[model samples]
Target: MLEAANLTKKYKGLTAVDSYSLRVLPGRIHGLIGPNGAGKTTVFNMLTSLVEPTEGRVLFRGEPITGKRPDRIAKLGLARTFQNIRLFKELTVLDNILVAAQIHKQYGFFSAMLGLPSYTREEKALHHNAIRLLEEVGLAGLAHHKARSLSYGNQRKLEIARALALAPKLLLLDEPAAGMNPNESMELMGMIRSIRDRYDLSILVIEHDIPFVMQLCEHIQVLNYGQLIAEGNPEEVRSNPEVIKAYLGRSAEHA
Candidate 1:
């Protein structure tokens, strides 16, 4: 559902992402893996238009969206979560999600200003949807709690749930398992897979967690020195000489 063709990025004459390309098929999980400085996040930024690509373009369902603004991209059904947890710390979990669902509101300004029945109806629908999303992410009981009071892993889940408020066709998750312990990570794995199927969406993930990424994604793309080094299923990537030499060994042996 998403494709990046020959994407390249340079900053002050240093190339960050060089001709990186990958495809995320419908309803499947695709992985982007690389060592530090490999430009995985740069690719995500380019796709989301947080950074313009120095060369090439990105396509969503065959439409070129190379340099669209970040809001435009999100409006067009591309949603994502950051490597670092980002939440409205003081807001309740339900409010955080309600904020995101605003992007899809349809009532006119006249309706809003007049407190017309239409706006009120839309507001009620959004609130219900937000509550449903919280439940889907396993935060139903904490809907009224302040975001900052949740554990680290629940914070991550809340971010993902908020992203879902956009009703995206493609979801990009950067380091979804970054801070979780083994049990938490394992739970996240199942949750990711379940949500992908439940929501009927494609996912592209950039993660340093080897086993987590391999086990979760249907296809894997490996990067080193800001270039594509290998692309295949889990076994092919793990046994590839270049991947093993560049970063896979350390990843495999990592606790």
Candidate 2:
């Protein structure tokens, strides 16, 4: 559902991302993996329109979406979560999700001042939907709790919940398991699978946890030194000599 062609990004003397091309099919979890500085996050930023690519194009459902503003891309059914958690610390979990849902509504100053029937109905529906989303992510019980009060794992799930409030066709998740313990990460893996199936989503996940990616994603793409070094199924990617030598490396010290 999403295709990137020869996508490249550079910053002055450094080429952060090389000409990389990949496709994400509907209802599949595609994994993007690399060592630090492989430019995986740069690729995510370019794809999500947060950073303009130095060269190449990004197409969503066959239409060019490169160079669009982040909000515009979001309105076109692409949503993302950051590598680090981004949430309103003071807002309640439910309120955080409600804020995201408001993007889909037609709210204006006059509508709010006059309390128009349409605006009221939309607001009510947004609340219900936000609660539902929170419930889906296992945070409904903590809806009224401040975002900062949640545990680290719950915070990650809340981030996902907030992203789902945008109703995206394609979801870009950067390191969903980044700071989680083993149990939390394993729970996240199950949640990812469940949500992917439940929403019929096309997901692109950039994760440093190799075993998690291998076990969860249908296909894996490997990058090293800002280049697409390997792209294949888990087994093929795991056994690839170049991938092993470049990414995993030969010696135990390298791993």
What CA RMSD would you report for each candidate? 2.5, 1.9
Q: For residue 111, what is the lDDT in candidate 1?
A: 96
Model 1: how far is 79 from its true place, Å? Answer: 0.3
Clashes of each: 0, 0
lDDT of each: 0.92, 0.92
Question: TM-score per candidate, in order?
Answer: 0.96, 0.96
Give model 1's TM-score versus the native structure: 0.96
lDDT of 1 at 17: 92
Model 2 stretches with alpha carbons more than 4 Å out: 251-255
Q: Pairing residues by index, what is the TM-score of model 2? A: 0.96
lDDT of 2 by residue, 1-255 (tens): 999999998889799999999999999999999999899999999999899999999999888999988988888889999999999989999999988887788878799889999889889999999988988989999999999999988999999999999999999999999989988889899999998999989999999999999999999999998999899999999988878887656843464
| Residue 127, candidate 1: C-alpha displacement in angstroms | 0.8
